[model samples]
Target: MKELAGKVKLVIKFFPYRYRDYSRIAAEAAIESWRQGKFAEMHELLIKRSPKLDRDSLISYAKELNLDVEKFTKAIDNQEGAAIIDRDLKLAKELDLYVTPAFYINGIKVLGVRDSDYFKNIIFKELENAKKK
Candidate 1:
């Protein structure tokens, strides 16, 4: 969850603001499936739901972002890019995380789906908790 979400945040940062929300939905859905202990279901979610190829769809997104398509394509096509994913998987294993959207504030970890306020409150509490250290 930590790994993928971080990757999503990085990927989405390159896209247009209009796509940020939609992109998050897609990433969140994948995370939800992982949280449910249903890895098989991730494929269903990743299935081609959009009519256009991600690149084509992202053209306007790139334009809005004022990003260079060539560099973006090169980065996405790199097999080494999956290294981030691999590292995340390893971290998840050490952390005993079987779900997505998990939060690890300081050394404390949070797992599974949660409400918006839940994260906000936890983060705030984490901040206070950290102060005691």
Candidate 2:
């Protein structure tokens, strides 16, 4: 994907499940990290340490990433990123998306887990279509 970075713009939207007790908080923490220019770092950490998204754990991760722990704590505590997360949730509902890994590539929807070959095929097809246009 890094090879296509300049050609493809990847936009990540948060759609944390309500049933997952720590989903919302983890989303908030990611947003906080985004504010501090550490979104990717925090995202990777959260994924690697799933089900450990307690406040202390999140703060510890932030500290590990050398982020401003105080600011991160305040943002999560105040739920500063709730609006963004809520908007994503609403969009997911409107799109009838109930899955974690849904993708919309040039209006083509691919849902569920897919392997690298699947993505490569999609991207190649899209690129060919783009060339034709």
Could you say which candidate leads in lDDT? 2
What RMSD does each model have against the real structure? Answer: 12.3, 1.5
What is candidate 1's TM-score against the reference?
0.50
Q: Model 2, 3-111: lDDT tens per residue?
A: 6775786688999998988999999999999999999899999999999999999999999999999999999999999999999999999999999889998889999
Q: Cα deviation of 31 in candidate 2 (Å)?
A: 0.6
Deviating ranges (above 4 Å) for candidate 1? 1-53
How do the predictions measure up, each by TM-score? Answer: 0.50, 0.90
Lowest summed lDDT window (length 10), candidate 1: 7-16
For model 2, the local distance difference test gives 0.93
User: What overall lDDT goes with each candidate model?
Assistant: 0.45, 0.93
What is the Cα-based TM-score of model 2?
Answer: 0.90
